[model samples]
Target: MKKELLVLVSLFLSFSSFTQSRESEVDRLNSIIQDETVHDTTVVNTYLELADQFYLKNPDTAIYICEKALSLAQEINFLKGQSEAHDWLGYLKKDKGHYDAAVFHFKRSLSIQKTLDDKLSISNTYTNFASVYTKKGKLDSSLFYHQKALFLRQSVGDLNLEANSLNNIGSTYHTKGNLPEALRYYIQSLKIAEKLGDKSSIATGKYNIGFMYNQQGDTAKALSYFLDAKEINEEIGNQSALASNLIHIGHIYSKSKNYSKAVKYTRQALCINNDIGNAYGRANTMYNLGFLYKDQGDLDSAYVYIKKSLGLLQQFGIKNGVAACFIGLGQIDYEKNNLVQAQNYGEKALTLAREISKPEKIRAASELLYQVYEKQGQGLKALEMHKLFVEMRDSLMDIESQKSIIEQNMEYEFEKKEALKQVEHEKEIAISNAEKKQQQLIMWGSVFGLILVTAFVIVLISRLKTTRKQKRLIQKKNKENELLLGEIHHRVKNNLQVISSLLSLQEKDITDEVAKKAIMEGKDRVNSIGLIHKLLYQDDQFSGIKMQEYTQKLIESLSNTFGFEKGEISTNIAMGDTWLDIDTAIPIGLIINELSVNSLKYAFDKERENELEIALTEKNKQLYLSFKDNGTGKKDDLFASDSFGYRLVQSLTRQLNGKLEIDDNDGLHYHLLFKSYKRIKS
Candidate 1:
């Protein structure tokens, strides 16, 4: 009986252990679910939980689990859950650098978010899309999408997200080498974060600002900002943030020629980053150390560090970083007088840099190539590479300068509008206070009747003076408008006459039927401009001429002169209440004339079904003029040569400083773009 009891107790203990193991398994599953699920606790959550469990070590199982969750979410029409699953899958694919798969899942998520009108989720999707584009070195598209996300975040009043978007925008600008603009946006983001008491965002912004300053050659300022950011991150126990700041500070010190301090900071950063398993951070620190050593004349150490960094970057498939490493190696070889090796490395780096759209890297590689060829006594090749380098550098600098100008203009306009609104608001408040005081005086008028009367007289006199001042300002503006109109009319008439005389002279010399036809076409164009000025002078309202009537008269006159009946050529003109100043109007008139003439000459070759459509619209401070004709399309090379007519059209178009696109798909479509000018009517 005692032996039997011992066996039963051992069996009971084994069964109890099995039950505990199953419970622990269940608990582990629940923990995974807890991390994966955002809000909904449904069967989809179980699938996501399973997916999370296998995602790291078992991608196939994770993918299957994700597919199951996706299917279940679709079955129940759970868009949010579906989007979440897709996002997770996309992130997983991105981790593997499967950009196509990642993009597909991200787009799926975006489609769901768009359908649901989930602004926050849509913003998140845009941010993700921007990340992909940035990785691809499509900076312009990335910036556009990031700005879209920023607008969405702002519209939704997502302050934290807005700050993130701002930071992302600064990063995009920084990549494009607009350091001052980047710093502006970064500082703005930092201020926003400080307002929200977001330590992480503040730290990130401060560090980025410091990095931008460092790139601008302000090492002292960069170090100050970096130290500030590092101190804050350290205080908050953010090891990753602190380490990033340290790396940036190291960069600044290296730029400042302080190799020892740079090495110290970089080593510290590398240790922290490695401890945290931040591969990207480790790679960056390594690169910094490589630069430090190179600057300190330690070529061997530089090569070691740079090669290590390149290996880490290759593991992550960072093409830009790899190109950078190649360029660094090329520079080292070039400095060591290894011309062949330098050229090889530089050419390889150049190829990769071009693929990755890294202009700075490309410029560096080009410079190296130029040097290598020059050293090899290949002067022509060196000169060619030098010229290319200069062209690329100038183009990049121009783009940066233009971008800066645009940003400055936008900011200035925004501030100006805000100031105007504030002034108007203050004026309203002052008027309200004055009215209240007047009412108070009226209430106590029995004792202060004379004083109130005197105040009223004084106020009346002041208002009259203000009215006179306003009238004078209005008169001055009207006078300026009139003068401008007169000048436009004068210039238009003078230009048209000059062209008419030139056409006449050309008509005398041309004997060929086609050549004579071209001269007459030129004469017709000259007449079109002359007609515009005639109409302008005929109208009492000098603000804008009536385009419909003006066009009708001009076309009718041209048809009569060309000996073509109005019914022979169909005219369809749809113009809005659009107006342009002389600068814009002359070019548009000439464009219209050219299109009309081209249509008349070539459109109705066989049958006389000459269908023409002309339309104009002003939107978004741009004027769009479109001319379409159902005619035999001209060859694409029609505008390639610099003929008299072509030159006239091209030069006029350029004078307007606008874009001109010609489409010959169906028949002929001519579109002209120019800035819209609004003239205040007197």
Candidate 2:
């Protein structure tokens, strides 16, 4: 069950990945190919990339796959895809050493790229052509193409590719025997690679440096650099690079006459090439191994190895490797005393080497043929081969070439010393400029700091003057406001007294007792609010009035209005320093006034002692008020009265945030428990 579940999970994950890849690759490709707005063309390019991975490892299968991609691209009228396929085909052909076929493909790719106006791709195609030309021993053509690619790459500002182009130009110069020029370009390329931190490019640069030194006969330095490059390639696991490094190292060993070590290195390179299916690399390594065997005097082993190498070379169409292999086989036959076979092999080597226009190969083949023809008793043929051998050898080692090399080396060294001196001079100038800049910065900073401090002091002094002026204005405005409030309050109190005087006069002219009583009640209500304003205007705190003093004043006014002597009403006041703002106090005063007047008039009798008890206190944040009379107690129906005073008292009590209850058993009693309005004390 667990195994089945694991299988199901794996299938689910794989299906999901496949769906996503299909969406991104195939579906996106369809959109790009159909839509002119889209510039990206990855699907066909990706197929070519996939082919590249397998092509070296399994050429037959990868070629078929790549060809299928090309066909599909052509069929679909995908120009970019066709262009990419052509470039990839060119690379594969170049790697296999089919120069003519490679050139044909690169030319096609370049034409397509130019038609598409793809500058970068056009530059890459140029590079590919250069690589093929370099392998074909056409130094002038290789250098021309490399320079063209470099220009285009630089125009596009691709620094990484610019470095690659520089390296390729350096390689071309090296092949042309311009070691100093090659080293300069190599150093330039190396600096860019170092800046980019491209390890692969750095390794290639080191290898090129080593190869240049090897050409200069600096074996120790060459070996050190080669080993350094080899270490990096090994660490990076670049199998192709590792194979190349091994082959170069093997060449160095062979030159030093260390045949065993040479054979070992060549064999290792051969193994790498075989594993990676690099036919050209394998062929070259095999030929080197055969040469090592020849150096060790192992004729049979040399013949066998060279024979295998010649076959691979023929299969790959590598003329250089094939020519070298033929020479090796010829030398082995000559050393074994097989003159006729040696002559045959030597003749084939010369023909092929001349056809390829490789002067070095031609010289070697001519030298070998000279000995073979002499041994075979062909006198005329021997002399002709000898003359050709001397001619080719002298041309290859001409005086001008030697002088040119020496002059370039001397120039390079002189420039190196000049560059060092220039760098030191620039360093001293940089220090002087930095010091001057630092002093200028210090001087400017001090000036800016002084300006800031002066500005702050000016602003502080101005702010202090403005603040003092504002303080005086605020104080004057406050005094005026206080005096204005006091005058207004005094006018309001005078207006209430005038209204009370008019009511008294109106009451004297009246005949109805009830109307007279109503006027007196109205006058007393007006006076109650007036007294509150009197206390307000007396102080600067326009906040609240003293409720105890306010109540005492209200009762005294009521006693005078009713013509009751102080002894006519026994008043017991229990209010503390309770202060009430005008809003709550006005309603409270009215209710107290109405109740006190009612008690003094109706709830009291001449025949009995009457007492008006009023108390206001706070408990648990609630205000309580008790007003009672030792005369007559009324019914509990507060809304039952049509009398204005009775209704006013009930309405005012309801206005407060408390309820009213009448208890007639002890006396006419009013008890209120206010849960909302708070009692404030001052």
Candidate 3:
């Protein structure tokens, strides 16, 4: 229903950047730094601690403070202090989008920590490295480092750090489009943070939960939690969060058609991002604004904002965002009737989306490209793009359907498969990086040829892999479903039987003969439908009703209901084994119920030997049915009545599109002919 490409808080996958007030800690660390006599490792550690205190609110100042610690530690040979400084600097740099530098510092921190044999320090460095990888869009690498930190933190019994790692891992999974896994990790992280009374972490969890809800199409619930989280973010001075919250809120408002409020909230978020120098946040917020403008039919505004967002995203090299912006630009151009520009933008978007291995974006780009191509008289290209679009759309649908089916039928059935997805994530970063580089070099030349080859090959491999991996899953599920389906049929039949019993119980109190007879007939009609279900679940072959046994049972049931003696009426059936699908069997059952009830109630008398006969057979590819009873024939027309049974017989005859004939000569007789019905497999 919704995606986090624009709405969700970036911190859902990021560490909680906000913390409780550190003024007192900052003051104490400053006091230790100013002590001229205390020039030991304590002094170096003091500088590192102070740098950590300032990092969030003042990143540049924090980096400046950490550099002094790094220098002093090198001079004094304080290895621990140097590692801590490097870790803090890496974190500070990562927050500011200085990814390459962040990695450099993080690697140095890990190197020193290896020598120091400090598990906590090493894990902390690992966490920083994970964040750097996350920002660089290397989700596989991000998850590996996050898992490493998580394990170490768990071993150290640091619930706080463990919560952070869990949240980071969830964030990585979220980026990979694995919401179930993401929610699993987020819940665990939230439980620990709530236990630790960490409001910052709580706020992070709140928004992530909201994002999950947003994806679920629960906009009101998502908005409620987002607003509550925003209040907490405000309380904790979470700067990035302020902007992130408004962007989410704005998107919701835009969905509600509250354009003015959406615009206000988004512009406010953009201003916040600009103030904080968060290029990523700014780029995304602008993208949201552009899309928002586009939705409102402010095409010019959409083009302007989207164009700007495209530039910033290009600068950051976020392929996902880049592809989305291209789609937006393409849409705007298509609206402007610039088919050529639209095609150009769609091609770029499709290439980048394919390069990034994002199916949703690929689908969007393919659709837009096909429309543009068709308009430009490129029928073959349009057809090809349309075919790809369908494959992507269908593949996504198949995966989603299978996932839902598996989840609903058997909880935890997919748990083991989750581990399979966790592998190759480390290579994900490397592969993505290499693809982006290669694509950039060859994009303007032979891009379509390259993309066509890459897309179809990848498409085939992915479908094959998905099918192979889930074949057993689906087969097992189908087996389970068959059992479940049988049980459902059994319960339905039982429920109908209960209703029939209730009618009989109610009929016992009725003193009127006519009303009692009507009640008897109503009960019998219910029984007719129930009998089909009864036959269905009683046997393994459930596709059709076995008419030979089923008709005998129906006659036996009616005879018992009417208190007729077993030998009082002689019955004959001409049909042998005829199996009709449930759809044809049901109405036929009801028709038989009405006709048999009428003969038992009105056509028969105790003075004469009763005789009944029913014939059903197929000839000339047509079904023929006959029923007759030896009794006094009524002078009145049988079907000329306002009774439900009379109308029901006529309606059912019309429903099957059959012709029916009745004769009142000597004894009542009915003949029916129908087009051949669907034959269920026996």
Per residue, candidate 1 scores C-alpha lDDT tens digits across 1-682 of 2233234334433543224554356355544444534433376776676566445434554676677678768877888889989987887676556778889999999999999999999999898888877777788899999999999999989999999999999999888766656767887899899999998898898888787767645678888989989988998989878888888887877776887888899999998887655666788789888988999999989989998998877776677888898888888888889888889888999898887677777888898899999999999999988987886665454433433533453354345335434544654565566556555544555345456878666666665565566556656655665556555556556666765775576467545566566557646765776777766766745435666677777767866765787598788888756556544565677777766666665566535566778888776777677888887676476666445565667777777667778888778787877653443332
TM-score: model 1 vs. ground truth: 0.55
lDDT of 3 at 312: 77
Candidate maximizing lDDT: 3
Task: Encode model 3's per-residue lDDT on 1-682: one tens digit a residue.
Answer: 0122112212221343333344456546666666667866887777776666555445666687788778888988989888888888887776666789888998998999999889988888888887777666677888999999999999999999899889888878776666667877898999999999998898888888888778656689899988988899899989898789889989888888999999999999998887665777988999999999899899999999999998977865677888999999998999999998999999999998776667678999999999998888999999999999987765543334323322332233123223323332433454466556545534433544466877656655655565555555555655665566576667667766766775676567656576566666666777888888788889855557888788889999898878897888788977787888766787788788888888888878777788899988887888788988887865365746567787888788878878888887778888888784766657
Prediction-by-prediction clash tally:
0, 0, 1
Q: Write the per-residue lDDT of candidate 2 for residues 307-368, one digit (tens) a residue.
A: 99899878877777888888888888899999888888899989988776777788889999
Model 2 clashing-pair count: 0
Candidate 1 at 194: error in angstroms? Answer: 3.8
CA lDDT of each prediction against the hidden true structure: 0.73, 0.75, 0.76
Q: Which stretches in model 3 have alpha-carbon errors above 4 Å? A: 1-68, 92-101, 274-277, 394-397, 400-682
Which residue pairs in candidate 2 have backbone atoms (N, alpha carbon, C) closer than 3 angstroms, thus clashing?
none
lDDT of 3 at 606: 71
What C-alpha lDDT, on a 0 to 100 scale, does residue 640 get in candidate 1?
67
